[model samples]
Target: MLNRTAKFLTICLLAQPLPPAALTVTAAASENAALRDISKIQVDERRLTEAVASRTLTWLTGSPANNDYISVGRLANFFGFVGLRVTSGHSLKRSEVARETLSVLTEQQRTQMVSLVHAQKDTLNRAHEARQEMNRALEGLLAFEHVTREQFIELGRDYGAREAELGRLLAQTFGDIAQTLSTDQQRALTDIRTTHLSGERRQGNGGGDPKLRQSKADKKELVNLTARFLSWTTGSQEFNDFEVVGKPSQHFGFVALRIGSNHGVKRGLVAKEVLEILTPSQIDRLREAALQNAREFPMFLEVRAQLMRVLETSLSGGVIDPAHTAHLGAEIGEIEASMTWSQAAAMLDVRDGLSEAQSADLLAMRAKYTAETDSSDLDDPIERGRQLFAQCAFCHNSDSRQPIGPPLDDIVGKPIASDPAFKRYSPALVRYARAQSMWTEAQLDAFLKSPKALVPGTFMSFDGYEETDDRSALIAYLKTRK
Candidate 1:
């Protein structure tokens, strides 16, 4: 046990963040160096390199939602916003001065817009659920050795229909919002859209500057290494889940950590608990689990990469055909799911194995970490909400520049599923909305307590704020969105 501990320490020491080197066609020099070091122990340098490259390519071409080889998400990226800049900042922030200058929605206009959005909620929800179900079904078909072309075409047709419905809903909402806008407001939005488009064009001119891409790639590699280290140590699904370790994403590693529970505070705290509080027996078990994960990691990567290649080649004709390729995609999805499940299982095992004293010690460490990280002003719930909302910014848009989830501005007392700019409320949320006339404070509180519990099929990825104070503060902050 002592030798294993020493060996693990040495490996971690060697894995310490190193200075990034220049990029190469195949892989960044720094990445190769890091992988080479790991290869000496468990990973296969070449196979891992190929996998990483495929993963990176998959990210480059995929949507922000999912990194599937071929799915509605990828299709959305391809057919939805092929070369658009799609502004990253909030739409409300367009004006440096008074907020109303850019977004001139009166209470009446807001109400009308909200009503229009609400009307489409059922259709949008149904379409979204259909797409989701189709994706899942398609994912299941991957284990099969063969799939007919007709199968891919049929799935493609369904995916296309669902995607088209979503697009129509978006367009309809935008049209309704535009009708509500006066001439000046329309001009303001047009100007913002034009500026964003120009910026996108410039970015695409030389692939947004090779230097920028290279720098980003280098940093991403290091970030990936750190996340991988975190997973190997803690086995927390937050750092090692399906989206983070199981699949490739442009927004993997640190970026993905933003939406995790407790805003991922547990990630930093878990290592301390494992190192200082865990028993010798527990550590030995964790070490063995880590070793087992390390051994399996390379094979999963290799198979996933290979599957991605097969899917890409089979479906490269600018058509959404899933057939045999869907099988491969499904297999990839399964591998990703397995990766997540295995780590989560290991984490649960360790958790179940913990002594009450050890668990108490870990909880104490967690409380300490949470307190240390709590920089919000206790006296001001709104202020605290503003600080805490960082966890939410990733999914919810503060402004109206195409939200991943929904716009939160003036959400309190507003009709549920009534964001003019967002039309993709899940069926569960829509059902919950039908029972409630508006987003009452109590409803928000209960929903925030556990979103899935309140609205089971809602696609809001947040696990909900557990602390009552935190939830209150966030609701307070949200009340000020108007």
Candidate 2:
């Protein structure tokens, strides 16, 4: 009875399908459809073989002889059967055969073939890593979950089924390459499928307490974190593992900190700190800004979503591991934060316009506020503006010859309405230019603060500069242009 049961188990294991191999085969089949015509050529197999062999020899030895003639004769005989007359024309040459084969492939078919090959290569690599991870997780299960060897194996099978499902989805969505897979590749995939199946069977039959099962779920949750971190770092949503555990609500102070801490944002320090940061007025402005700058700032929605997620994560006791935390911090630091309204209108230097009492009032309102004296005279306004303009490099170029927008070089001195070469300018701009004088530094500064407001009909769709300093720096930088 024992031997019979063992044999039954082995049979069950052998019956399980190999997902990677299946996927590989699927891809291979797709490629073979295009190669089939070439393969079907009715050539004298021996002669064609000899010709290929002699050609390889000639390449290696740098010599041609009677033996090569024999190979050529064989090739000619093969071509004769195919109705290709080598003696009459060059149509029967080897290069001609290659050209014919290439000509037979449609553009779409060629693209599909290349895509399939690349997908297969990537899938093979990922599947290998997945298998290794599955194995390691199983081995470590004893340490992490205190499960028996049988239990561990059973758990592995369940995970394998889930992985197989993912693989199937990937193959369907990304295209399959299994038909082209080699025997060895098929064998490896088969082994993985078999192992997973065996594990699933074990888990189903070896029943355990409900509480223990719950604990297993918790352990899986932790293991999932590692997977999620990897996915996040790799910039793919398919491998998303993190789950939001709480409800979303607005908490201005919390929102401010979260936004500040976010990777690549550095704006709204004091206003964000205000307990009621998003006041009715501020909210209206933001909504209007969103509407006005929708095209220029399509990524705002994504940024806001991430901000909410960070808020939820912070409120919950869930700590993103140190590595992920550091990476997020770095990304946030890279962002050039916008200034508040007051900051934008401040004097360019010396702060002569602001009274001490006004400055003190601003500092008193914020929980964390520190004032730094600008006594060093090291603040090169042009250099500061250049630093701020770095953020705009992704979508704009200062060089007029190569730019998404009209180049800013010598833009200040140009006539408001004329530049025939600038085809992309909005009609509103041409109208404005016809009516108004050339753009002055102060006018440019205000326009930079709120682009839509100044020229409602213009196409310069940037979300207005968020900070007074940033706007000033940008204006200063623009002034340096001839």
Candidate 3:
């Protein structure tokens, strides 16, 4: 039924393709159909994945201006009033208000908030998965040369089902949180909500510009502070770890937010501690790394802005060449990779000279927020692999084009470096592939254990999964793709 409807709509669209006015009408009709379908469909709980859940909650609770179009400032305010602080002012530095909110909470209150968030994690993930399913349907529609109104409607219907399910879960979670809040907490939250809704723009120092008061020294200090905070959060100096094909810092940022919004509390303390132990030469190396990051970080943001423009154009129904999007994605990926790599290398160079006690202090600080995976709940290898694959999403699109690396579709048993579409495989990998032929489960396991070990100088920059179970789970998950 969908295929026939799509075919008919496509024919109708193509019939009057010459007129701009006709095209606009057809687009509007399609959009209406999609919206109508969205209202009618129901969500399938079984198909929801963790990635979808994480994204859904993040989007639902993020800032409207920065996170994504679906982000609602009101939702962010609500979450911020609680323990989570996913959204903040437009700055790389951590939000002072968010930190203060969490700090003011009693231990019991913080624990309650954490438990509530964790309890709702599964439901949020399912909703997120539903949205992802809708997006996949949309992608399928977009693949057609002339997408039809009926196709849009059909896609909408599928999405509508998911949305309905999502709405139910979200409402329940919200009510649960609201009912759990103490009277005092509720009152404070109400005040915070009013402040957000007021939309007051007071001129603190003539026209409300805060940066005008900053001295050159203050600005330099901020840059160094940001660089150090990022480094501490990541806790890695491996260049390979940072050179992946997406915004690497975002993962760190999100981790900090989800854990406890602890960045604000720990960043300054860690910076001071590290400085106390650093030798003059180590200090110089660290400073150089901070300066490099301070430089590249802006360029990374600018490239990201460019990518956003391309996406906006496409979303606006403008005819976009896929190659253009791919080019920009690649460009932004490289800039982010370079920035992270420099920051990591600098941290490594400085940390190399740290005494045992100094090393322990850094480790102790890191352990405060670093969460270990709870294997009890996620005992399924495929499920665990799916969760672990979030990091890999930065470089590889499983169901779509291999934007950075070869697509993983039917990767199991495939010959290495043989995806004709992925032309940028390192020569070393190709030679190894020719020698070894097919990527057997054993070969894949070995490769995942250490990419460089299997094929020296391989293009894959992953540091490898050290845990046997992790490697096995990832491999098992990869096999299920087909």
Which predicted model would earn the best TM-score?
3
Clashes of each: 3, 26, 8
RMSD (CA, Å), each prediction: 21.6, 30.9, 22.1
What is the C-alpha lDDT profile of model 2 across 351-448, one tens digit per residue? 12222333233233421322111111216766445544433432244322333456566656567646566667778877777767688777677778
lDDT comparing candidate 3 with the true structure = 0.39
TM-score of each: 0.31, 0.24, 0.32
List, residue by residue over 185-288, the lDDT tens digit for candidate 3.
53443333223223322222111212323355443333332222222111111110112111222322223224443334333343455455556776666566
TM-score-best of 2 and 3: 3
Model 1 bad stretches (over 4 Å):
1-272, 314-321, 368-482
Error of 3 at 416 (Å): 1.8
Alpha carbon lDDT of residue 315, candidate 3?
21
Per-residue alpha-carbon lDDT of candidate 1 for residues 1-482, written as tens digits (9 for 90 to 100): 00111121111112221111100112232233212222132233232232332222112111223311222122212111211111122121222111222134455644443453445456545545544443333222221113443443444345434544443333333333334455554444334333332332212221121221225433342222222211112111111111222222222122222222334533323344345665666555545544544555544444333332332221212222335443434443333333333332343344445543554454344334322223333587775575455445434533323345676768899999977666678888888878886998999999898988988888775567778898898899888777
Clashing pairs in 3: 37-156, 37-157, 38-156, 41-161, 42-161, 43-161, 52-128, 53-125
